[model samples]
Target: MWQKSPNHQSLSEEEESKALKKAPSLRFRFILAGVLVIGIIASLAINLIFDYSQKLADLSYDRLLRSALLQMDENVGLIRNEVSIDIPWSAFATLAQAEEDRVFYKVESLEQGFITGYQDLNSFPPNPPVLDQIQFYDQMFSGEMVRFAWVQRYITDPETAQTVRIILGQTRLSREEMAAAVTQKAVEVVVLIALVAITLIIIGSHLVLRPLHRIERALEERVMGDLTPIDINTPKETHHLKVAINHFMARLQANLEQLENYTADAAHQLRTPLASLRALAENARDIGYSNSASPEKQHQALESIVQQCDTLSQTVTLLLNQAVVSHRLQTHRLELMDLLVPITASCREQALTALRQGVHLSLECELKESLILGDSFSIQQMMQNLIENAVRYSQQDQDAPAEVIVQVMEFDLFYRIKVIDYGEGIPESEKERVFERFYRGRYDVAGTGVGLSMVRDIVNHHSARVNILNTEPKGTTFQVDFAKHRFDGDNQ
Candidate 1:
């Protein structure tokens, strides 16, 4: 019923293309993840470098403002109990070292109101500093960010004391430029490192996946329909994959061999019957044309043609059953089942087939159930073929009463099935040859010679043994023995 399509190859190719597109590339994913991790780490490093540079730049410039404030504090005096001060030239000179920056300074007396330089500098709310101590702060003055250092001093002449404040501020142009330069250098180094890491990621991923590429190339180079086992050197990680592929190919090779044999045998065995049918049909046509020939002769020719057709149909059926059993032996998984089921079923079917021969077929299964690890389809095929072989040979003698007996017996270690036929027994010389494909004995019986061959194959598949023995008076008994405990421990 299941036939291979004419365009099966093309459809498989299309499906393979779709599958490749849908499958994610392992190398590409690894590289992408590595790049993403490098990008995140590089960004964090850049931010940390920027912050460190900004703090370093600020530390360098704050010392200059403090020196200028200290110099101005030393120049303050308390003459006539009133605040008086002379600003030092060195204080302003030190502030002028930053060429691109603007500077501002102020000196004031708290109790006596505004004193010496830059009264408008009061825009910054001044916090009183500890005596003789310097305090630094920053603020926006005249639309520019400024850094300021403040210092306070008290002068006493035994009459009255006055508190004076010295403050100096500078624009932050040079400090900002220094921080930007340091950050730019660090960023360049980080970008270079990231690029190097990404390049290494690509190379490493390629090396790790080289084995897979080798396997693909090996398969691509093989000829189509080559089911031989693949032999190639591979790493331990991929060795199991190679083994699995070899196993699959071995099964496929076996199936193809079975199909080829079935096709050839079916053609060879069916040829004679087909040719006989054609001859009978031609003979019947000739008999009809002859006026001298009686109608009874034409009827006899028609009957012979019908008989040939039946033989052809039976041969075809046996060939198909052989093919089905061979295929199932390759593909079907064995399971725990009762062996008696197929045996009884085969007995019933063969009994109906032998009814026309006036042969009495009987089943003798004493056990309720005989459990075994086996493929049911193959077991059924074996039973059917064995019983059919017996039924065909049992009706050889027309004088004696024909009888075929199918028996199932169980033992401690194994199970035995026997098909006994009361017919002209087979000689010891031809017993083994009868199991060969299309090898029939010299008996006038309707048969295709495929049943016994199928039985032999099924027996070999189950690792069982078969024997043929002559009965007491006149008959042949085909005995098949199967081990009961085969693969039972493996299941556990």
Candidate 2:
């Protein structure tokens, strides 16, 4: 049960401690999920930012085209009853700042042919725009994509009413260059945001799971049997877990203390009887070889020796049973123990003892359900102790049989094993103390006081109940409730 771990075979104390500290520090899965979710969100944000930057750059470039086209609008005026136009360099200078864009302009008549400017400019479709309205569109010009702005002048000439149309177009080299610059900056910002987001996520995840490492370190640093409570300086999210760990350690400490005390008490209680037995046997030997000693004296000494021997045997047996029960309960290791096996075996072993003592022993198991969970040896010891105790304490009736009835009955959740003896029942005041280790009750019976105590320990180990109640005719009955084991049809 206490075997070392296979991995620990090659590890020093410091190395094993380090290994324990490393395992519970951080979980990779949580960190991975956090990074993944943040990456997806950052990607979406970067896409939105990139698209917005492109639109902004395009809006700025479109305004430049509009400024150049407005300059052309001023060139229109009627002269000598004919439409006149003036071309200005300032009109094209704002768009020409890029030094790579090809700017073109055209002025024509709705009723007449071309008036001035670029003669090959494509005609602007649709009706003239509303007063002071300017229309902008994209078109392929001279085998290159161009941006155009169109304006119409509705002026009544002195001789005739006429509408004039003016259109301006520019190549896209400058606008595309501006958009590329904006896109480059936007991409740099997106990359920086991704790096910052991932870094924060890693840091935050480590901080959140740091308490788990604290708990692991706390457990690792403790020496053997150091079931101390953990510190409570923990995060609010993990406060409950820390408290639960402390509570578990407290329970463990208390149980270990109990086991330690039981060992001390057993050693103290057994030493006196063993010493007396040794002395009595030596006295019996001395009397047996004495020439002047009488037969009755030697016989009395022999009887004393036998009595002391029985007491020692009973004490040692009960002590061993207590230890076994304690070990099983501590380890929580048990198997399917048939209830009928112990009930039948204990009665068989105590039958002769009971008969010689004028106590009748009987078994009445009418219940079909008898399976239970416990160490078989511990269960058997408890049964024998209860039976022998009944035989010793039962008041002998001169005219009637002083019998001990072992009855087994079934209930919804448990099986009740009642060992009833028509003896002087225990008083109400001492009922609770009867189960104390080495508690010698008011009975003058020739037996060890540990039998009932061992019985109680075994009962607790199996998580069963033992009730001491009075019989109908002023006697005692020890009724033990053993929980039925959960078994399938195959096991049965």
Evaluated with TM-score, which candidate comes out highest? 2
TM-score per candidate: 0.63, 0.65
lDDT of each: 0.84, 0.80
In terms of lDDT, which candidate is strongest?
1
| Global local distance difference test of model 1 | 0.84
lDDT of 2 by residue, 1-492 (tens): 134676675566668788887775445777788678877887787778678766776688778878877777777777766777787788777887768989887888876769987898875646656756888777888889887888887767668766888888888788788777777787787778778877887787788888988888888777776776786488888899989988988878877787788788788768888888889889988988899999999989989988887887887777777677777667767787778887888999999899998888999987654778877777788889899888877744444458999998888778999999877678998899899876877645666577788788788877989999998776788989988886577467
Global lDDT of model 2? 0.80
| True lDDT of residue 125, candidate 2 | 46
- List clashing residue pairs in candidate 2: 394-423, 395-423
lDDT of 1 at 171: 90
